[model samples]
Target: MPRLLLVDDEPSQLKALQRTLRGLCPDLHMDLALGGEEALTHLRARAHDAILADLRMPGMDGLTLLGQAARWQPLAVPMLLTGVADFATAQRALNETGIFRYLTKPWEPELLRAHVCAALAEFQHRVTQQTQAAAWQAEQGVLSPQELERLRLEREEPGLTHVEWADDGAVLMPALDAHLPSMPR
Candidate 1:
C-alpha cells in the first residue's frame, strides 16, 4: 500500500478528502497536514509515496511547497488539489510545480484514485528503468574521460547537454544519473 500525504489549510477540505478517499483507496495510508509547514514536517518525518496539496494557502503556497518537497524527496510524486478554474493557474501548476495532476474541486473518488494509481505507476516505471540501466552499465564497459566530462556538463545544463550527447543515442531525465564506463585515458 502506498502512503499518501494530504495537505490543505481548510479543515473542511481535509474532511472532504478523507471522506472522498476513504472507501476509494482503502489500501492507501493517508497522513494529514493542516498547512505547508505541517506538511513539510511530516514529509521530513516519513517517506510518503505521493503528496496531494491545495494550491491556495497561506505561508508557503502549493508551488513553493512542491518545489521544496521535490528537493527533499525527488521521487515523491505530487498532485495539486484546487478549485481554481483559471487557465493561468493550471499552466503554472504544470510549469512551476511540476504536478502530476491538477485535480479540480468536488473530486470523484475514482478519478483521484486513478491519478494516484497513475502516479505510482509512473514512479515505479522510472525506478525500474534506473535499476535496469544501472545493472546494464555495470555489465558493460567503463566510461572514457571524455564521456565522464560530458556527463559532468550534462549535470550542469541538462537540456543543452542532452542535445550534445544525443548523437550517441542516449537520453535521460534530470533525476537519473546514468553510468557510463570509464574510457581509456
Candidate 2:
C-alpha cells in the first residue's frame, strides 16, 4: 500500500487536505502530524511514499522538516504548501530540501491531486527499480568495477544500460550477436 504523511499546525487545514486526497489514492495509508516534530517521529518509525507539509509551523518550518525528512526517508517525495509566496524560501526548498513541488495556499484541487498522484507514481517507480537492481546484484554476486558503475548509472537514469530479459529467466545480450558469425538463417 502507498503511504503518505501530512504535516500542518492547523488541525482544520490538515483535515481539509486529507479530505481532498482521501478519494484520490486507492488503499492509501495516510498519516497526519500536528507539527514538524510529530512528522519526524512518524518518519523515523515508517517509510512514506510522499510527504506534504505546511511552510509555516510553530517550531520547525516546512523546509527544515523536509530537509530532515530527506535524511530519514530519502525516497519519500517532499512537497511544500504555504499561503505566503516567497521566492527565497521556494529556492531554498528546492535546492536544500529537494522538494518535488511547492504549492501556494488556496490551490486548485485538481492541480493538487495531479501533483500528488505524480509524486506517488515516481516513488513507486524508484522502489521498483531499486528492487530490480538488488535482485540482479544478488544473482550475480561480486560485480566488477565497470559493472558496478553501469548499475549506478542505470539507477540514476533508468534504462541507461538497456537491460533485456529472456523468457527462460536469463539476461539477453543482443549486442554479442553482431560479433559472431551466423550459422544458419
Candidate 3:
C-alpha cells in the first residue's frame, strides 16, 4: 500500500482533507500533520511515498519543509497545496524543492487523487530502479566509469538507447538500424 502524508496548519482543513482522501482512496495509508514541524516529525518516523503540504503556514512554510524533505527523503514525491495562487512561490517550490505538483486550494477530489496516484507510481519506479542498481553493483562488484556513464544515459534518455543483456552479464548496445547484425542462429 502507498503511504501519504498531508500537512496543513488549519485543523478543519486538515481534517476535511483527511476525510475526503479516506473516502476517495480507502486503500491508501494516509497521515495528517497540523504543521510543517509535525509533518517533519512524521517524515522522520517513516518513509512516505508522497507528501502534500499547504504552502502557507505559521512556522516553516511548505517550501521550507519540502526543501528539508528533498534532502531527507530524496525519493519521496513532494506536492504543494495552497489557497494563494502565487506563481513565484510555485516556481520556487518546483525549482528548489522539486515539487511533484502544485495544487490550489479547493482542489477537485478526483484530480487530487489522480495526481497522488501518479506521484506514488513515480516514487515506486524510482525506488525500484535504485534497488536494481544497488543489487547489480553488489553482484558485479564495482562498475567501470564507462558502464556507469551508459547507465546514466539510459536513465536520462531512455528512448535514445536500446540495451540488451547477454548470457554472460554483458551489456550490448546495438545501433538503431534495420541492417544491424542479428544474433547468431
CA error at residue 181 for candidate 2, angstroms:
70
RMSD of 1: 12.5
RMSD of each: 12.5, 17.7, 17.3
lDDT of 2 by residue, 1-185 (tens): 88899999999999999988988977998899988888876776667899999999999999999988876566689999999999998998899988999999888889999999999998988778876876687578856667777656644543445656899989986454442334676
Q: Which stretches of candidate 3 lie over 4 Å from their true place?
A: 23-26, 143-185
* Candidate 3 per-residue C-alpha lDDT over 100-139 given as tens digits, one digit per residue, 9 for 90 to 100: 8999989898888788888989888987887588568857
* Model 1 whole-model lDDT (C-alpha atoms): 0.74
In candidate 2 the C-alpha lDDT for residue 116 amounts to 93
**Pairs in steric clash, model 3:** none
Q: Is candidate 1 or candidate 3 better by TM-score?
A: 3
Question: Of 1 and 2, which scores higher on lDDT?
Answer: 2
Worst 10 residues of 1 by lDDT: 174-183
Candidate 2 residue pairs that clash: none
lDDT of 1 by residue, 1-185 (tens): 66788999999899888777775544778889888888877766666678899989999888888887776566678899887768898898899868898988878878887887788777667556655665565557565556655544533332233332356677535323222322479
Give the TM-score comparing model 2 with the true structure, all chains together.
Answer: 0.73
The deviation in Å at residue 78 for candidate 1 is: 0.9
